[model samples]
Target: EPEVTQTPSHQVTQMGQEVILRCVPISNHLYFYWYRQILGQKVEFLVSFYNNEISEKSEIFDDQFSVERPDGSNFTLKIRSTKLEDSAMYFCASTKTGNIGYTFGSGTRLTVV
Candidate 1:
């Protein structure tokens, strides 16, 4: 089975720095998304994408965050300015349809210090 791939499995950046988390979801999937899990907290939805546009986003995905599917293959989440509270395990997920059979990337761990 194909898998969603994330780069730089772990990253540590100082507060205020910019960071871009990258992901490559299964090629045939139609929906892609991002979510984060703070060290001890449940997963928090960040954003969702479809047809080259942001289909939906949560409050946490504020001005400081952005997502793009550059080149139609690379899905990326950019944090314009890092904050201590932004530290978390960021996951990438995709599905052929929006409602079922989701496949998730291992995750990129962000550590904002």
Candidate 2:
């Protein structure tokens, strides 16, 4: 079975630098989402994309963040400027429909130093 893939399982970046987390969603999946877990906090939704447009985005998805489908199978989330608070486990997920549970990647662990 196909699975979502994320790179650099752990990332340590400076507070002012930029970081791009990469993901390859499951093949044949049409909906993609990005979520984050701040250490012990609950999972929070960042953004969701479909049909080449953002379907929804939470307040956390500010100007510093952007997402793209760089190619047929790759999705990316770029943080233009990092902050200490931005450190978290960022997970990429995809599902064929909203009614079903999502399949999440192992997660990219971002650490702002």
Candidate 3:
């Protein structure tokens, strides 16, 4: 079985600072996504990428947020300016198809102070 991998399992940053979360999806997968969950809240989708372009994005993915596949295998999320509200567990996921099954990375816990 394949899985998504995220780095720096945890991160602490000052408010207004920039942060980049990294992930590597299953090599064979075609769809990739970034999702976040504020502590005690439901998971929220941030953005979806396919074929080197954004396929969909949530309102949460505003001007401050961006996603990139700098290399064919590494998918990354950049937060231009962090906010206390942005402190959460960010997950990376991928699937061969947009079906119900998706492999999600353990998550990167970002804490904005």
Candidate 4:
């Protein structure tokens, strides 16, 4: 089965630093979404991307956060000025179509101090 792959399984950074989390969605998938889960909290949607554009975003995806597919392949989430509260496990998910089941990357655990 195809799977989404995220780099740097874990990361630790100082407050106010910048972080770029990378992800490669399933090759055949057409829709992609970024989500985050605080240590013990429920998953929270951040943004959705399709057709090389961001289709929707949650309030949590404020100016500090941005998503982009720089090339035809990988997707990336950049978090500027990271804060302690921003520490969480970021996941990348992809679906062949909106109706199909999603394949999610294990996630990148970010720790902000």
How does model 1 fare in lDDT? 0.96
After superposing candidate 2 on the true structure, give the runs of residues whose Cα lies further than 4 Å from its correct spot: none
Measured with C-alpha atoms, the lDDT of residue 26 in candidate 4 is 91
Q: Give Cα distance to truth, residue 87, candidate 3, Å.
A: 0.2
For model 2, residues 50-111, the per-residue Cα lDDT tens digits are 98878999999999999999788999999999999999999999988863768999999999
Per-residue alpha-carbon lDDT of model 4 for 25-96, expressed as tens digits? 999899999999998899999999999989999999999999889997899999999999999999999998
For model 2, which pairs clash? none
Cα lDDT for residue 101, candidate 3: 81
Clashing pairs in 3: none
Candidate 4 regions with alpha-carbon error over 4 angstroms: none
What range of 10 consecutive residues in model 3 has the weakest lDDT sum?
94-103
Count steric clashes of candidate 1: 0
What is each predicted model's overall lDDT from 0 to 1? 0.96, 0.94, 0.96, 0.93
TM-score of each: 0.98, 0.97, 0.97, 0.97
lDDT of 3 at 22: 98
